[model samples]
Target: MFKISRRKSVNLSIAVALSFIAVVAVIAVLIPFAWENTPYFSKLVNDVVINESQQLGRCVFFVWLYICFAIVEACCVMVFVLLIRVRKGLVFSEISVDCLRYISWLCMLLSLFLFVGEIFHPLMFVMAMAVVFLGLCLRVTKNVIELATSIKQEHDFTI
Candidate 1:
């Protein structure tokens, strides 16, 4: 019989979530391009643009969607790496700090992207605010981990 610890289960859950996000991000990136020639997509472009430059609007929309998905995919990869480090008991290591720092930056970038998107759709402001909050929380988590690593090294040297 095999036993799974609570911590391991939590880590596994996080890994699964991150994987799911990555999969969804890939799908999102693909769907826009795949449906670019579809009638529904053309109608959507016409509706959104309400101008004669529907083709240009469609192109811009695809590019923006791809950029968003790329950022999300990058964030998912960073989180997966961080979760792997946690599973390996390397939470206090420099690699973990780097992962956290990068994730924080990604969150900030996502927030900014959403903020700009809000100019076209006001509802995106809520998502932008949420990403900003998540970024701040990740930044604090990174600082705390850095501080703990420093304290651990100091204690080890003293002993």
Candidate 2:
């Protein structure tokens, strides 16, 4: 028989959540690739055209969508790596810090992308602000974690 500690159970739960996020991100990326052939996506495109000016070509719109999805996929993969590190009890390690930094940068990139997208669609400006806020939060969290890791190492060496 195998027994799992409370901490292990928590880690497992987190891992499951991260896995779900990764799957969703992947689906998001795949959907755009399949968008041209999917009737639902085609209808959605038609609706957008009906509401907005048809100045944006479909190719350009899809290219931008793919770029955004790629960024999201990269961020999800980084988060999954961070989750693995957490499961191994390496939350304060350098690799974890790097992962956090990468995720933060990805968020920043997304914010910028959305900001540019806002030129064509006003709603994207709101999304850009939200993404920038999230990125700043992650950056702050990464800094705090790095400081804590350094302090812990100093304490260990002193003892």
On lDDT, the leading prediction is 1
Distance from true location, Cα of 19 in model 1, Å: 2.9
lDDT of each: 0.81, 0.80
Itemize residue pairs with steric clashes in candidate 2.
none
TM-score of 2: 0.74
Per-residue CA lDDT of candidate 1, range 42-149, in tens?
665666644469777677667766777888888888888887777778888888999999999999998888886653466779998999999999999999999999
Quote each prediction's TM-score. Answer: 0.82, 0.74
| Candidate 1 runs further than 4 Å off | 1-4, 33-44, 47-52
Q: Candidate 1: what lDDT?
A: 0.81
Worst 10 residues of 1 by lDDT: 43-52
